[model samples]
Target chain A: MNAQYRHSQPGYLMILIGVILLVVAAFVWVYGLQPLEIILGAIGIFLLAFGYKLTVEIKNGFLRFWFGLGIFWKKIAIEQIVYCEPFRGVFAGWGIRFVWNGWLYNVSGMKAVTVVLKSGKKIHIGTDEPVQLIEAINSVLHGQVGVESTQMWSEVKADYLKRVEQALSVARHPRSFEILADVGNHLDRRFTELEPRQQTWENFQRIITEMGPPSEYAELVNEDKKSGRLKLTKLEMSAIGVLLVVFGVSAYFYPQMPERIVTQWGFHGQPSSYMPKPVGMFGTPVIFAVLVIALIVIPRTASVSVNIEGFRRFYGGLLIVFSIVMLAVQYQIILWNLGIKTNPNVVGIISVSAIIVWMAFRFYRARRHN
Target chain B: MNLENWQTQLRKGLLDIVVLNLLNRGPSHGYEMVQTMKRIDGLAIREGNIYPVLARLQTDGLVTSYSEPSTDGPPRKYFKLTEAGQKALEDMNKHWDQLISSLESIRKGTGL
Candidate 1:
C-alpha cells in the first residue's frame, strides 16, 4: 500500500523562544524563586510542546497538517481541493493566523502552497519547497495512479469479515465489537493494497498466516482488556488514607493554635497571606483533599481514550507526592502556631521543584519507551 | 568480522541514499519502492519498514507526498524528491563514488 508521506517544518523561532524562557526561568529560580518562575517554566513547556514545529502529511486521501505534537491540527480531503498554487505575496507573520480570505499554517518562510478547497476557502501551507509541494498536489489531482479493483476486494471481503468475526468471537471481551471493527478496517486497507492476482482466498490465507493464528490475536485482545480495567490499588487507597490522617492530625492542633494562621508566605520567608483561625487551619487541607480526590476520580469517570491502568503506578506516585507535600505544609503550619519559626516558602519551592523533576523524568522515560 | 551482519548493516546504512536515488528517477509509492528494493539481493528490506524510512525522509523535507485517488480502491500516496533531496542524492553519490574508488585502489594494491 501507499503509506503516508509527511513533512515537518521546524519552528526554529518558537523553539528558541521556549529555550530562552526556560533559561530565564532557571536563572530566576537560582537567584530568587518566585511564582513567576513557575509560570515562565510552564509557558516554556507549553511552547515546546505545541509551537515547536509544523507538519503536513498526505494520508488516506486527506491533507493533514498539524503544529507541534499534533496539539493543533486540520485535515482537508483531497476531493475537496480544487487546485493549489505556489503562493507569492506579502509576507505574513507565521504560526496559524488568518490571511486574506482563509487561514495560513506556516512555521517559517513566505513560500507556501495555497490550496483552494471546493468551499472557496484557501489554506496556505508554508514550505521551503513550495514548487515541489504544488507539483505533488497537482499530480495527485491529475495523474493516473494504479488502484486495486473494487471487484477483486468484493470477492473476498465477505469471507474476510466472516473469518475476522469468528476470530473475534472467541475473545468474549466487552470491547470485542470495537476490536472487530478495527480489525475489519485494517483488513479492508490490507485487501485493497493487494495486487489483483494476489486478491484471492489463497493470498488472504497467507496474509492471515503472517498475522498469526486467530487464537493468538484473541489471547492478545483478552490480555489487553484484562490489564486495562480501572481500579484503585491498595497503595493508592493507602496514600489517600495517609492524606486524610495528615489532615486529621492538623485538625488536632486547632485548639492550641493562634487566632490567625499563616497560610501563605512571601519569597523572603515572611508571612504574606493569612486567614481566619477556622478557614486558615482547615481551608487548604480541605482544598488539597478535594483536588486529590478529583484527580483520582476524573480519569475513571471521564471519557478518556487512554488506558489509565498503564499509568497506575505513576498516578499512585503522584498522589503520594501530593500527600507528602501536604504533610510538610501541615507540619510547618503546626510548628508556626507552636512558636517554631520555619520558612514555608523554602518548603514550597523544594516540593514544587521535586514534583517538576519527577514529572520531567517520567516524560523522558515515556518518550524513550515510545 | 561477521560477513552477514556487515552486509546487513551496510545495506541499512545505505537505505537513505538508495531511497533518494530511486525517487530521483521518478516519483513512486511505498509498495513500489519496497518491490524495487526486494529485487536487489541482500537488501532484504521488509514491506512494512519502508514506510518509516519514507516518513523520515519526508520529515527531513527531502521528500513530499500527495495522494492520487484510485478509480477502484483508496487513494494511492506517491512520494517525490524535493530540491533538497536531489542535492542530498548528488552529494551522497559523489561520496559513494569516492569510497568505491578508494576501496578499489586498495584492492588492486595501488597505494601511495
Candidate 2:
C-alpha cells in the first residue's frame, strides 16, 4: 500500500465515542451512580480508548508518513517539521489548528506539526488545510522554483481539476456569456498528467507518496493505527485516579492535618475540634475526597493543542493555576464542613479576590502595548 | 445577511464538494487542497478535526496519495480519489438533495 493512506479502526472511533461516554459518566456520577460503578465505568472508557493498538508510525522526509498498529504511534521525524505555532485566541486555539500555507492538520492536542529542513530549522504550519500548508512548505523548500498558479479546471468531467473550476465558477456565478465561454475552454485541458499505466505497481507506492492531501493526515492516522498498553501521560489524566488510592487510606485512617497533629501531640492541648463529617461517618469524608479529586484533577485533565497564536501555552498556564485555586477552595470547604476551627468565608473571599487580581493582571498583560 | 456566518455554514456543508473538486483536477496534495479551499469565499479554521474525516474516507479507499520531493522542505504529498471516493461523493449528493427537498417542503408548508 502507498504511504498516502491512513486506516481508521474501531479503536479510533472508541476515542471519539469516548467523548460522549465521558459526558455520560459525568451525568451518572452527578445523578448518584454508585461510586464503585462510576469508577468501573471510567475504567471501561479508558480501556476502549486504549484498545489493542500498540504502535503508530510517521514517515519523515519530503512526505511525512505516520502509521502504526499499537500503543506507540509512528515517529513523526522531527526533521520534517518546519515550525509549531500556536493560535492564542482567534481560532478555537484549544481544539483546532491550521498550517500557515492553509492546510490544517491537527497534531495531537499536546503537539503541533512543523516543517524541518535537513539543516534542522523548523517553521509552523497546520494539518487542517493541506493544500495551503503544502504550498507554504514548498515555497520555503523550493525557494528557487517560481510558483505556478494551478488554475481551477472549469469543465465538468471525471477529473478533479474541472470540478474545482466548476465549483469556483458556481461560487462566482459569472453572469456573462464571454466569461462563461472562456471558462468552458479553460476547463477542458488536462492540468497534470497521471503516470503511464505499465508502472502501476510502482505507481501504487509512488502514488502514496504523491498524493499530498491524505498524507497530510498520515501522522494522526498512524497515531490511531494501533496500541495496547496505555501511555503513562494518558494514565495520569485524572487527579481523581491518584486520589482514589488516597481515598481508601483517608477513609481507613483520616490523615491528620499538621494543626491537628500538633494538638494530638499535646503541643496545643484542649482538643481543637475537627469534625470529619456531620452525621454518616462516610458522608463527609467521601464528599471531601471527591472534592479533592475535582479540585486537583479536572482542570489538569484538559486536552491541549496548538493554534495559530500560541494557544497551547495560554491554556496550559491557565489550567495549571485554575487547578491549584480549586484545590485550595475545595480544601477550605471540606475543612469548614468538618467544623474545623477556620473561617472558610474569609478564605473564600480571599481566593475570589486573588482570582480577580490575577484576571486583571492577565488582561493588562494581554492588552499591554507590545 | 451576515456574510461570515453564511460563509461558515456554506464551507461546512460544501467541504466534500471542495475536496472532491480539488481532487478532480488531477492529483494535488492535502496542503494544496486546503489552500484552494481557503481561497474560496467562506472557509475558515482548518484543524486536526477535519483531517480525521478525510482519513476516514481514505480508509474506505476513496482517496489516495503519492509523495514527490518538495522543492522547499520535505517531499510533498499529492492526492486524488479512487472510484470509491467518487461514488461516495455521489451518495453524499443524494443525501444533500433529500435534505434540500425536505427543507424546501417545510418552508412552503409553514410559511414562517
Off by over 4 Å in 1: A1-230, A303-305, A311-314, B1-112
* TM-score of chain A by itself in each prediction: 0.51, 0.27
DockQ of 2: 0.05
Top candidate on lDDT is 1
lDDT by residue for model 2 (A1-370), tens: 3332232223343455556666776766554433322434554465454532222222223333221223322234433443322322223221122222222223223223344332222333323343454454444443434223211111112132223223323222111111221222222111223222322334333332332222223322333231211122322344345345434543554433333321111112123233333222344345545555454344343222111123323333344444444444445434543557554344434545555565455434432311
Error of 1 at A323 (Å): 2.8
Candidate 1: tens digits of C-alpha lDDT, residues B35-103 = 788888876564433544564566566888876755544345688999999998899999999999999
The CA root-mean-square deviation of candidate 2, after full C-alpha superposition on the true structure, stands at 20.8
Ten residues in a row with the worst lDDT in model 1 chain A? A302-311
Q: Residue B109 of candidate 1: its Cα lDDT?
A: 83
Calculate DockQ per candidate and list them. Answer: 0.02, 0.05
Q: Report lDDT (Cα) of residue A68, candidate 1.
A: 91
For residues B3-112, write the lDDT of model 2, one tens digit per residue.
97786556655666667766877887555565566576655435322444354445556787665665544455556889988888788878888888889989898534
